[model samples]
Target: MHRRRRTAVVVTSALLLSVPLLAACGNEARPGAAAVVGGERIEVGAVQSKVKAVRVAQERSPQAEQLVKDSGQLTRAKLYDLIVARVVEKAAEDAGVSVTRKEVQTGRAQLVGQAGGEEQLAAMYLQQRGIAPGQLEDVVRRDVLVGKLAEAIGATNGQEGQQKLNAAFSAAAATLDIDVNPRFGTWSDQDLALGEYKAPWITQVTQSQGAPVSGA
Candidate 1:
């Protein structure tokens, strides 16, 4: 009886010691399972997946497709959007701005309007964007809360407010230290045939035509 009791005690102690090691191993196995922002752990995979989905949507656009082919702007834009969203979310939390169901409903209504109505919007988002009707409400709620927090941080209706907001945005953008992967995001208009061109012969041609040149 004494030997059995001692053996049980030893086994219990061993199991207790293994628990922490097991937990550490589990965490190591899932590298991106959690995202640590300001010491808070949010689900990293969830946010990353959402960002990818948005990128996929942008990829479907003709201009976006061409841009992505020349420069990886799609991925960079997605990263930028996520970083900005996370910052805005943090700001909202700091400002104590809360999103309510009613506010989410209002946001959903606005999105529906942009989508051209509830039925059509639902089909379009579901089929093309792979976003469910319910999920859109959550997205809208977060956006609305962020907007409200921004307004609160920099009041909504004055020149001072506008300046404050611009300053705040600039500061936020600076702090993000976004390192855009050039292969995915950098492209010159010359490479894409999208910017203006100087025509040296045009000036002489117009002069020969006797066209009135203002201030000439």
Candidate 2:
């Protein structure tokens, strides 16, 4: 009877020691999701699919080749932006703020009128920016949400509101558990944005007067 009791204690201790290992293994095992936001898995396959769609959308531009050579940049950066933007959208909802299609359209129309009308806006987005009208609309949607959320939170005027909105989003993002697949890089808490990770390195090393510098 004593032998069985001793064996049971040994097994329990083994499991207790293994618990931390299991946590590390859990992180390693999830090599697939591009990001895990809150509890939702933003799948790598879906991100790539969206990337492809964005590239296809830009194909209508006369400058498509130059845009493609620019590293399919919109696909790369916007996917990260979209992920972070979704987090902001959640925060906006919690703040009881929302934007509608009409708001986006009305705001966009005002901008169009300000920019000297529709043709000018088209030239700005498509020709100069190489962004499709549909893509611009997506940008408008996020912009409207941010503006509305900022206003609701008393951040309604000038750059002050925008700064306040940034603070609010940063606070919201900090409260969540977020992970990014190494391939897609890291999420920046400072910017509440995602970008490819770069290992920190000294861009320039300077020596004060009479100081010696050595390299291996």
lDDT of each: 0.38, 0.51
Summed backbone clashes in each candidate are 3, 0
Tens-place lDDT digits, model 1, residues 1-216: 121111100000000010010111124533543323334333444545654564464466444554334323322322333444555565556567776787667556655665678776654543433343544554455445544654567434445644554455444434443332222232121121101211110011111221211110
Total colliding residue pairs, candidate 2: 0
In candidate 1, stretches whose alpha carbon ends up further than 4 angstroms from where it belongs are 1-36, 40-48, 51-71, 118-138, 166-216
Per-model TM against the reference:
0.44, 0.63
Candidate 2 TM-score versus the reference = 0.63
Task: Report the Cα RMSD per candidate.
Answer: 23.6, 20.6
Q: Count clashing pairs, candidate 1.
A: 3
Worst ten in a row by lDDT for model 2: 8-17
Residues 132-200, model 2: lDDT tens digits: 465667655665566556556866444564566567776767666677665555677656545532221
Local error of candidate 2 at residue 135 (angstroms): 3.8
